[model samples]
Target: MREVAFITQNKEKWLNFEQAIFHRRFKDPDELATLYIHIINDLSYAQTYYPKSRVIAYLNQLAAKAFQSIYRTRRQDTNRLLYFFRTEVPLTVYQHRRYFAYAFTLFFIFVAIGVVSAAHDDTFVRLILGDGYVNMTLDNIKNGDPVAVYKSGSNWGSFIGITLNNIYVSMRAFVYGIFGGLGTGWILLQNGIMLGAFQYMFHAEGVLWESVRGIWIHGAMEIFSIVVTGAAGFILGAGILFPKTYSRKTSFKMAFKDGIRILLSTIPFFIAAGFLEGFVTRYAGVMPDMAALIIILGTLGFISYYYLIYPFIIHRKTVNSL
Candidate 1:
């Protein structure tokens, strides 16, 4: 990015800030403060890249004027929980959205490896899924219900067990980032391979459709949450790998906090996934096709919207709100 290009790109925003500050175009300090943060960021960039640039003085002037307006009308925000989900997560996720793409790309590659391996090798699925589980599923398939495994436990018992396991898996993805995200990638590889192998086994047995409704009744959100948490893990690792302007220790602390918040955001979705797996998936084999499809699509849509699409929407709204 050349200095001229940078100035050209940000000129409109700078002009907006200038008008807001000099002409009293914005009385709301919250909005002005938000604009101030943008100006300060640009000032920092100008100072770093072009130490003697005239743009720094202009940005500094805008920042200094906005500072007084901020404190004069600043009000404490009371709805911490609401803000965390509604504003904080969206902004943070948007900032690191590329990590999600990385995680998902890895997920697809690993899953494809699993599928190809299982397709070519008769025993590869068993190697990944283990003999006992494979044999049990085969037995269920023979009995005309390929997914009868879901019916083994009481609903509440299964829900509690599955939810705990999900939370544990999510935290593992986050904690493993201490190892520079390789640990999280390893976890994703293992799980992705297993999922691919599991699905292919049913396809090879001519029960792919039977498995789809039952498995995806909950797997939609469950799988999405895992990938998301894995992205959080990468975010955690990135702080250590590329600390940029901050010290490594400070970066680690910041990434850890942000990663934990991202992990926390997945809990409700995990619980919902667990509830579906325990209570709904067990009946998917017997439920009406329309009903099963609705649940599957609904869960998938809701989770996908939140993690994939909503972040950008919120980000655009926040930036354009100025």
Candidate 2:
């Protein structure tokens, strides 16, 4: 097709992709994949037909972004891979995938510092959780109701309340990125450190295994959502930091919109996690070990298939059909 003919024919598609990537919700994985193809085609066409055009160069950069999204979604395959992707790689991408090595290096260094400090100091968890919470938890444990905090209400009521609250927290974290991304960074740091400290507290009490079996039934998905929310915040903050071709204001707006959409996508995950925490975790004392194991394994299995296995299957099927 002639350059203009292709441009004219794809004008709608181009606009759709542009809006989806820069404006629409990020949850519709299919739209994201479709946009990837459109962007790749547009950039290749521009290079072939209008190499010197500034417009072509700009679109090419956006196309690169589309490709990176594909890579991010693609890596979320196996449970092991999904664990890494959901927890680690997405955060790195938030900082710019190009800097993943540096970001991870710094992350591990900080984690090590946290681990070492906690190892030496019995008071580290207190510092992280605060004396009030430690005392409250100790009081609960002494009363023969270690996890009573989660068992205080009707299961369904707690489920709805907690789910809604978690979603709001995640959305706020993303929206707060308007404060020049510091808000997002602070949220991530505080949560990450608290998680580590929480785990350490259980370990110190010689209940780490019990804690993992009981808590991760819900914590796995809930915590993953938190990380993804952080990614959304990063997306918003990134626009402000590196506007690249567009005016800073325009880039910031685009990023903020996308970030909100990313946060919106986590609603269902939060709901499910909340249900498990409220109903299931609260009854861990009476629930079968096999049931909790199944729940944890099943959730991880779903994440593995949707993110990692499905993509490879699609790619291979397409190759074979061709």
Candidate 3:
């Protein structure tokens, strides 16, 4: 592609990205993600497709300037949340897959920790879960209803509480990026170990599959939200660790902004997960087999669609456009 042609082809997208970043009251996640993808693609194309061209150098400079502009002033409004969901969240998921090795290593470490601790001492549950929560859960278990903790509160109240709590957890996960992302990894490790230990306890009680079917209805989304949160933290931390051409502060600021944007996108997912856990999870025994299956499958579908399918579609569309 010639310089003028390439510039013309992307002119509309660039303009939209600029206006969305500056003029619009709120930026759309879809638009913002699209812009991000475009800028990266432009740079990649310039470096690979026309490395020696003066146009390549000029475009690189242009992209750098544009990135700086957006970095300086992050316009957040109502559309901010919407754009985050449509673009930011999906991209985070996609980006995290590149670190599947890290995630798997963490998973194995947490699982081993749970197994080793459980095998060595019966009090491992207390270590994994706080003493107070463990005692409360044990009491609940002894009361002839192990899952009674999920049975409290009306549906609406539970929905609000769970959603808010989950979002708070996610935001905290992102905030931990300030520690150069080690804090983020700790959050993931802690959560993963708790999950492993919690499930192991259920297994000891001879209700592993039952708990899986019931709890995972919401956990699928809830856990995925955490993974995305961790990914966002990693992005921030990665920027801090490897600033490339930008100054440490500039890169860190940009990463933090993008990370939070990704975090913002997951609010609805957390709310839905909370609702499922609070309302639907309580009625696992009463919920029809088909309905339960549908909910579980639906949650999986949402995750797969956003994380895997949508990213592929967007990548192909952008590449084909160029």
Best by lDDT: 1
Best by TM-score: 1
Tens digit of per-residue lDDT, candidate 2, span 1-31: 6767867887787667766665654676566
Worst 10 residues of 3 by lDDT: 64-73
Which residue pairs collide in model 1, if any? none
Backbone collision tally, model 3: 3
Residue 200 of candidate 3: its Cα lDDT?
81
lDDT of 3 at 308: 60
Which sections of candidate 3 miss by over 4 Å? 1-84, 88-108, 135-144
lDDT (Cα atoms) of all candidates against the true structure = 0.85, 0.66, 0.70
Estimate, for each residue in 1-322, the C-alpha lDDT of model 1 and write its tens digit.
8999999999999988878865678867777877888897899899999998888756764664454345335424577787677666766677677888999999988989889999999999999999999999999999999999999989999999999999999999888988999999998999899999999999999999889989999999999899999999998999899765447996788688778889999999999999998888998877998999998899999988888899888656644544
lDDT for each residue of candidate 3 in 111-204, tens digit (9 for 90 to 100): 6788667666788888878899878867866665666677788888887898888888888888897788898888888888788788788777
What would you estimate as the lDDT of candidate 2? 0.66
